[model samples]
Target: MPRVSGVVGHVVTFGRVLRQAGLEIGPNRIADGLSGLDQVDLTRQDDVYWTLRANFVTRREELEIFDRAFQAWFLRTPVSPFELSPPTPQSAVLRRIHAAGRPDSAAGTDESPAARGWSYEEILRTKDFGAMTSDEFDRVRALIADIAAERPRRRSRRLRRHHRGRELDLRRTIRESLGAGGDPVHRQYRLRARVPRKLVVLCDVSGSMEAYVRPLLLFVHAVRGSGKGVEAFAFGTRLTRLTRALETSDPDRALQDAARSVADWCGGTRIGASLKTYNDDWGRRALTRGAVVVIASDGWEREESGARLLEDQMARLARQAYTVVWVNPLKGHPAYEPLAAGMRAALPHVDRFLPGHNLASLERLGEVLMGIERRHAA
Candidate 1:
C-alpha cells in the first residue's frame, strides 16, 4: 500500500544507481519500468522483480549488478557478487532513496537539477542520428518509438454517430419521433469518421547508405508499430518488401528477419530501376491514392541514364501521393547540398525535403505528419 509517487521516486532513484554502476540506464527506461510496475501486482516480489528486470536489463553483464542493486535497495540487504566496490557510496544511496520519496521544494524552478537535465536531454534529442554512439543510439530508438506511437489519423468520408456533429440524422430523428408520438425528443447527428493515413517507406540499403539503413529501418518499424497503415520496402539492386518482416513486435527480431529477407544488403544502388519497378508493380495498386510516401536515401545511382528514369518515376509518385517526403542523412551536414544527379532529378517532385541524420529530425518528421493530418481534417 505505498503511494504512487513514492514508488515512482524509488524507481527513478534505482535507475540513477544503475547508471552510476556503469549500466546504460536512461530516463526512458526508468519511465518504462514505472509503467511495467503499474501492470503487475506489486505485492508479489517475483512479479515486481521481473517487471523491473525486463525494463532495465539489456545485456548479460549488467544482470549481476542489477540484481545486487535490487536486493540492496528493495530487500534492505546488500549482496556483493564481485570483489569490486559499489560505484556509489552507501550514505549517498540512502540519502537519494530517502529524498526521492519526498516532495521537492523547488519542483518547477528553472535552476533545479531536473530542469538542467531536461535541457541536456533536449540537446541530445536534436543531435545528428548518424553522429550518435552506440549508447546514444539505443536511447534515441526508445524516443523514436514513443513519438511514432502517437500516430496522426486522417478524417474519412464516412460518417458516424456523434453528439456534436453538424449534420443531422434525419432517419434516426424520424424513428425516434415515432416513439415519442410524432414529436422529436432526442436529436441525432453524424460526424465524419477518422482513420490512420497509409505510410509507405522506401529505404535505400545500398553500399553508400549502409551506415544509415539500420536506423532508418528501426524508424520504419516504429511507424508500423504505431498502428498506422505502413508498407516498408528496402532497395539496393532491387526492391524487397519488408512489411511482414517488420511486423514482429520486437525491434531486434524484426531487424533480423528483415536482414535475412533482403538478398542484396550492401550492394550497388539502382534508385531509378527500383522506383520504376515499384511504380509499375506496386505504386498504382498500393502506393497511390492519398498515401504518404517517404524515401530514405543518399540519392547515389550507379548509371547516368538511371537519373532520367528516377526523374520520371519521382514525377509519377508525386502525382499519385498526397505527400512525398525525402529524408537524406547527408542533409545534416552544414555544407551539404542536393548536388547528386539522382537527388537533383527527384528534388522538384518532393513535397518535403528533410534531414534524417538524427533523432530530432525524425521527431520533426512526426510533427510534419501531424500537421498534414490537421490540415486535411480542416
Candidate 2:
C-alpha cells in the first residue's frame, strides 16, 4: 500500500501498460479505476489489485495482459531515485499505453483533475450519473448550480399593480377622475401578480439509487438558491424534509447538513409509504398549494402492497399539484423502459416523465418547466 496520490499515478501508469499490451483501455476506464481505488482498502494488496482489474480489464483475454502489467509496473524491483527517467525497454509496452491515454495538461495535475478540461465537461454533461467517476461527478456540481439558476418561475394567483391590465381598477379610476369633475376620462387596470412557483422535490435516497442521490440533492439545493419556493425531501424507509437543511448557501455544507438530517441515507426504498406520509401530513399544508412536484426515483418499490399505496398517493398528488414531473434516472439507458411496478403505477399520474440521469437531461427538465410557465402565462 502507498499514499493515495502515489497509488493513483501508478494505477494510471498501469492502465497505459495494459492498453499497449493490446487491451482496449481508455481514459474513462482509467478514471473509473482511480475512483474504484478511492473506495477500496488500499492497504490490502488483493483489494488494490481487483480495483484496478475491475475497471481496466473488461474482456476475459485482457485479464492475462492486466496481470502481467500489474506485476511489472507495481511489483517489480525498486530502482534508484536517480534512475527515474522514462519507461525502460521492458516497460516500453506500459509507457506507450500511458502516452496513448494521457490526460490533457491544461487540466490541473491532480487525481481529481484527471477528468477536467472543456472536452471532458462536454462528455460529462451527457454521461449517465451512475457511471460517472468521482472526478467527473465533482466537476458537474457547478454545472448543476448553473442549470438550477435557469429554472422557470411560475405565475401566482395574487394580482400586482400593472399599467395595462384587463380588469379596470375602479378605485384608482375614481381617484383620478376627481381631478376632472368626477368625469371618467382615464381608466386604470390591474393585472395578476406573477411569483416564482413553489418547487417540491421528493428524492429517493435508497440503496438502488445511491449513485444518483448526491447529484440530485445538489440539484435540489440549486433550485432552492434560484429564489423560488423550494421544499426538499429525501425518502427511503420514511420521508425527511430538507428545505431548512439545504438552506445553507454553500453547496457542500448544505449537502452535509442534508445527509445528517436524513435517517436513511442508502437503505431500502419504501416509495409508497413515504409518499403516503407526505400526502397525509404535508401535502395540503406545504407540498401541494399549486406547487410543481418533482419526484426523483427509479420506481422500484420494496413490496407489491407498497406499489398499490404509491399509485393512490401519486394520483392524489397529481390532482393537487400544478405539475407532477417524475425524474427517473434509469430512463437514460437506451434499452430502459418504465416497466417497474411502481413506475407503471405512477406514470399515468405523472405530467412530465423525464430522465434524471445526467446534466443534459436535467437541463431539458428546466426547459420543460419553462414551457409549463409560458403556457400558464398565456
Candidate 3:
C-alpha cells in the first residue's frame, strides 16, 4: 500500500460522500471503515471496496449509493489541482474526495485546518440536540449508542471462582487436596460476580419537550439495547411502557414503534399524575427497587396541583431506587435554573442532576451512571 497518511482524511471525506447521498454514516462508521482497511490489502480494489462497504452501508437501499461513491472516489483519476470553471456542490465534493485520496508526500506544504485539532465531530459533540438537522441527528445516533453501552454494574449474589478472591472455597480446596496426598498446595476462592445494574428510564414526551423527546428516547432505546436489565417508559398525560417497542435493532423502526406505543406522543404535561401512576403500578411491583432511575424531562407541569404530587412521588421513587438521575435539557443553557414547579419539587429527591442537551452531556451522563454511588437522601 502507498504511504497513505491521508487514509484518515480519505475515510472521513468518504463518509461525508455517503452522507451527501442520504446514507446515515456516522463518525464511528468512518473510524470502523479505516480500521477495516487496515486489516485488508488496500492495493486490492475488491478488498478495499468490500471493507468500506461493510462498515458504511447499513441497508440494502444504500447499496447503489455506496457503490457509486466507492467507484467515484477510489477508481476515478485525480482531478486538476486548479479548476477554471466556477465551483458547484458536486464539483466541490469531488475535489475534496481527490484531496483526501492524495498521498502525504504529494500533499501541499500548508496543513489542513483540521490538523490543528478542531474538527466537525468535536463541534457536533457540543451542539444542542434541539438545533440539529435530520442528517446531523442521523449521523449522531451511532455515537449515542456507543455512549449508552456503558451500563452501571452491581455485585451479584452468586459467587464465581477467582484467583484474587478474599473468601476461600474450602470445599473445592479440600476436594482437590485429596489427589495431592491430603496436602492443600492449591486453593480455590470465590467472589461475587459483577453484573449490569437495572436501569429504568422515565422520559417526558409532552408537547413542551418536543424538541428533545426524540433524542432522549433514542438514548433510552440504546440503553435498553445494551443488556437485559433495562426498562423504558414514556409519560406526558400518562405513563406507557416502551421497553418492548424499543427492542427493535433498527433505530428508525424502534422510534416509530415507540411512538405508536405511546398514546400521548406529544400532548399535555402531567408530570405528577404520570409519576403517581408509575409508582402505583410499576414501582409497587418492585421495578424501581435498587435500580438506577433516570428521568429526562424539562420539568413542566400543567395541572394546578402537579407540583405537590410530583414532590411526593419523587420522594417515594428516591427511596426505592438505588440512585435517581434527573436530566433537564434546559439546564444546558447558561441562564437556566430549576424554576419550573415540577423541577423544583423533584430536585430534593434527585441524586444527580444533569444536562441532556447534547452528545457531550449524554456522554457525561453515561460516565456518571458507570461510577454512580447510592445516595442517602431523606
Candidate 4:
C-alpha cells in the first residue's frame, strides 16, 4: 500500500539508525533488505520487522539492541537511553598497536592519517610483500580477502524481471492486461541476469616467486570462496590442481595444504611445460573457455627452450580464454622491464599485463577483472 520509493528510503534510514545503535550494517545488507521487502507484504508490520531483523542481525547478542531500535523506529515507543561501555583492555591494546603502526605517531599528534594527508592502509597497499614483516603481511591478508570478494561478471542468457529492461515480458504483460480491461495498461520487461564468470588462476610456486606466491595464492583462495566458478592451480616444474587444497576456510591452513600438495614447492621454473600440461588437460576440456584466466608468475624460465614453448602455449590459452591476465610481481620495480624470455614471449598474447606485487596492485587487478570490456584491455 505504501509507495515503493518512500519505503526504500525509510528502510535505508532505518539501516543507518541500526548502525548508530552499534549494529554492523552495510550497504549490501541494506539492498538485500529492500529486495526481501519486495517479496513480502510491506503493510504487515510483522513481515517488515522479520525481514529487517534477518538482514541486519549477525549475532544473538545484538537481538536486544535490534528489538529496541526497531520498536523505537517503527512502533514509535519511547525507550530508555542505551549506555555505552568503557573501552576494554583489549581495545586499549589494539589502539596502542594501531598508533604504533602510524607513520606520524612518533610526533605525538592525535590527528588521524586522513587528517595528516596519508593513511597507514595506503602505505600497506604499496609496500611489497617481500619487504613486509610477518605482522604487516597478516594485516595485508584481510585486505586481500576483501579485494578478492569482487568477481568478474557476465550477462546470462536467462532473463529476470527488470523495471527498465529493453525486452518485453509478453507473458506478464498478457496476464496483467486481463485486469486492465484487456488493454495491457501495466507492461512488464525482462533483462538478462548477470552472474560471476568462471575464473582460472595459475600461480607460480617456484623458488623464484617464493616471496609473492603466498599472498597471490591467498587471493586466489578468497576468490574461490566467493563463488562456484573458480579453479586454482600451482606450478613450479609441473602443474598441480589446487582447487581442493585451497577450499579450506582458513587462509593459513589453505596455504599449508597447498604447499603440501605442491611437490615442487621451491624447485626450478618450467612455465612452458606447466602451461603445456594445463592446455592439454584443462584447456582441452574447455575449462578456460569464456573464463578470466590469471597467470601469476615471475616469468623466469629455467628450461633452455622454455620461452618459445611458453609463447605457443600462451597463444593457445589466449585464444580459448575470454580474457588473459598476466601478473608479474617483479613489474612493481620502478625500472622493471619485460626482459625475461618467457615474459617477453607471453606479452604478445596477454590481454591485461599487471604488476601484482603488493596489495594495491591486487586491488587494481580486482578492478580490472570487474570492468573488463574489450578483448584486449591493454
Across 1-378, the per-residue lDDT of candidate 4 in tens digits comes to 355798878888888888887788999999999888888998899999999999999988799999998898889999976643322323322333334345443455454445645477789899999898656676677789998887888898999999999799999999999988899898899999988989999999887887798789878988888789899999989999999888899777677667767777778899999999999999999999999999999899998899999999999999999999999999999999999999999999998899999999999998888887655562
Candidate 1 Cα misplacement greater than 4 A, ranges:
1-120, 373-378
* Candidate 4 Cα deviation (angstroms), residue 168: 2.1
Clashing pairs in 3: none
lDDT of 3 by residue, 176-273 (tens): 99999999889999999988889999999887777787778778878777789899999999998889878898766777667766767678889999
User: After superposition, which runs of candidate 2 have C-alpha atoms over 4 Å from their true positions?
Assistant: 1-117, 150-155, 373-378
The true-versus-predicted C-alpha distance at residue 110 of model 3, in Å, is: 24
Largest lDDT belongs to which candidate? 4
Give the alpha carbon lDDT tens digit for every residue of 1-378 in model 2: 355587767877877767667677888988888878878897788997888888887778577667767777878944332221223322322232233223452256464534456777788889998887655665677788888775556556676768978778899999999999999799888888767777789999888887788888888888888785788999999998889889999877777667767767778899999999999888967568678888999999998698889999999998888888999999999999888999999998988889989999988887777567632231
The TM-score of predicted model 3 comes to 0.68
Error of 4 at 358 (Å): 1.3
Candidate 1 lands at a TM-score of: 0.66
lDDT of 4 at 126: 98
Superior by lDDT: candidate 1 or candidate 3: 3
Number of the candidate with higher lDDT, 2 or 4:
4
TM agreement with the true structure for every prediction: 0.66, 0.66, 0.68, 0.68
